[model samples]
Target: MAVRRIGLTGGIGSGKSTVAGLLVAQGAVLVDTDAIARSIALPGGIAMPALEAAFGPGVIDPAGGLDRAAMRQIVFADAGAKARLESILHPLIGAETQRQAAAAGEDAVVVFDVPLLVESGRWRAIVDRVLVVDATEETQLKRVIARSGWAPEAVKAVIAQQAPRRARRAAADAVIYNESLTLEELAQQVRGFWERWAKSSTR
Candidate 1:
């Protein structure tokens, strides 16, 4: 088998990261875009210079890392700010992701865990398969609230910004309905997908 890629996406608090860990356990090379983005926003990170230049010093913390909460407020409230951010980070993320992908060698199952894959549309042409981990909106609300200690309204706001459940489903080659499954059940599902995936499954 040659190298293959699976584009993984889900709404916030939809267990996307959990599913990603499961896939990694199944021998997939994981290229987590969000993690890369976070790394680049850290102090002295790759994206910091441009982010500081674009958004100014107020968006940086005393520790010199990105003031994520402030930036989140800016991006969420201002569409132009969001686009400016994507412009600054996307190219760097893409280049680094590709560089990591190139290191996978032959026959590797590369999983790109992108939270915004459905919303972005750019990943559609690149991946062999798209897998969406899904849950009901209410379930998502509850899970995030439970885990993050964020205000329910804040969680809802984030959820509202992401592509809807139906939209994500439409983009998927396979879907994992994660509304109420235990971790073991989810892991079983990932293992099943791993065993069954092949070039023949391409659309």
Candidate 2:
């Protein structure tokens, strides 16, 4: 039996997490790549040794974990550094993601909450569908600032670095316009989506 996988993605502050949670409530299994990445970067975690060697001691914190903030600054400024870093982490993350998805079992509707799904073109082929949570760049900036306390310019920079809105939309099999939705409204939309797919997957 094959698990039906949905690749869910959105820009920062676009409420993708909320949608993921709602789908989980509807009995969907979630394979969160970000959480897996964080876990692998923890002290003595699987990716730490390779990270330390590739990026050097300076990239590791005193606690022995990868210093994500410092590494972010390094990679974003240098494409080669970013590529090198991804080479060390991506394979590890992909393996863990696959293991988790497999453990979710055959009947599960697995939702892969991938923040960079659009940028990672490979994900599009692996999942049965792409569900994008969308909002205007202005909406994204304001929401991120309000929630994360990030500077408006910093939020804009992240948005700029992501695959553009048009590209994400083009890749989407379904879209959740989250710019003005209340939590209840957002959950309703997610629930409807899950119902439709869950019903169809059985047939």
Candidate 3:
């Protein structure tokens, strides 16, 4: 039996991470793309030097590390800059994700937590299912602002760069509405979905 590959995605602050954590607790081997991206741009990671070369010195902190926040600000404001950054990082992230997925054997139901699954387009063919955790844009804005202390405009800018909510929801094989659920409730939902998903995959 091959492991079932699940692409899990959502808009900013849609509680996707909370749900991913629950799935992890339930024995799903989680591969977080954001974490992978960050790691790749960290000091010794594969993509760091290329990133520094592409964006120049200011993009690197005094410690000679990628300043993620500064990069985020630049990419969020400039499409070309964002594309350049993704070109450097995405392939490295994808390679690592594929390597991890291959190492997790048949029983592992691996969840690839990607924030821009739809926008990337490359992941669609590789994944068995795309699970979208959804919330209204207003909810997303409020939650992001509250959690990250980002200004409203900044939060909105990030949101603008993502695929629209409707498009993401339409792409999903499963949808988890996360607007008003408690952590416990969200966990229960993930468990329930896994029960059904696991059984179906085995058949």
Q: Which candidate is the best by lDDT?
A: 1
Over 7-122, each residue of candidate 1 has an lDDT whose tens digit, in order, gives 99999988999999988887788999999999989998989999999999999999888999999899889999999999999999999999989898656789999999988889
lDDT of 3 by residue, 56-143 (tens): 8888877777997899888877889988997898889989988888888766788999999999888889888889999999999999
How well does each candidate superpose onto the true structure, as a TM-score?
0.94, 0.94, 0.93
RMSD of 2: 1.9
Better of 2 and 3 by TM-score: 2
> Where is model 3 more than 4 Å wrong at Cα?
1-3, 199-203
User: Candidate 3: minimum summed lDDT over ten consecutive residues — where?
Assistant: 194-203
Tell me the spans in candidate 1 whose CA falls farther than 4 Å from its real position.
1-3, 198-203
Error of 3 at 43 (Å): 1.9
- Model 2 poorest 10 in a row by lDDT: 194-203
lDDT at position 192, candidate 2: 87
